[model samples]
Target: MCPRRARCFNTTGPCSPQHHYMLPPAQRLPEARELIEMDRYFVLHAPRQTGKTTPP
Candidate 1:
């Protein structure tokens, strides 16, 4: 078997668990579920370079 590769922070495109170190998207907005369940509309806002455009 091949040796495990090292992971690094992802700077572009979607991140992969095998190649990048990242927090799960869900953890970033835990309240989103509650808002959705209540039938409320909400917007996501964050500082630049915070992975806002990255897909969950």
Candidate 2:
């Protein structure tokens, strides 16, 4: 896993060097689940063309 600035890839949409955010579903979902179980609010911010959080 990277402990530094995440490398990014270009997609068929607006993108910039600053929009370096990306994560695997395998990685992000568990973190979301933990926060939900604890009743803590959090935001899912990702780069263009990524998952949209919906309440399960």
Model 1 lDDT per residue over 1-56, tens place: 21469887666788777777778756877998899899998887987676666764
Candidate that would win on lDDT: 1
Model 1 ranges off by over 4 Å: 1-4, 34-47
Per-prediction backbone clash count:
0, 0
Residue 54, model 1, lDDT? 70
How well does candidate 2 match the true structure, expressed as C-alpha RMSD? 10.4
Instruction: Provide the lowest-lDDT 10-residue window in model 1.
Output: 1-10
Which segments of candidate 2 are over 4 A away from where they belong? 1-26, 54-56
26-46 per-residue lDDT for model 2 (tens digits):
574678677778999987677
In terms of lDDT, the poorest run of 10 residues in model 2 is: 47-56
TM-score of 2: 0.35
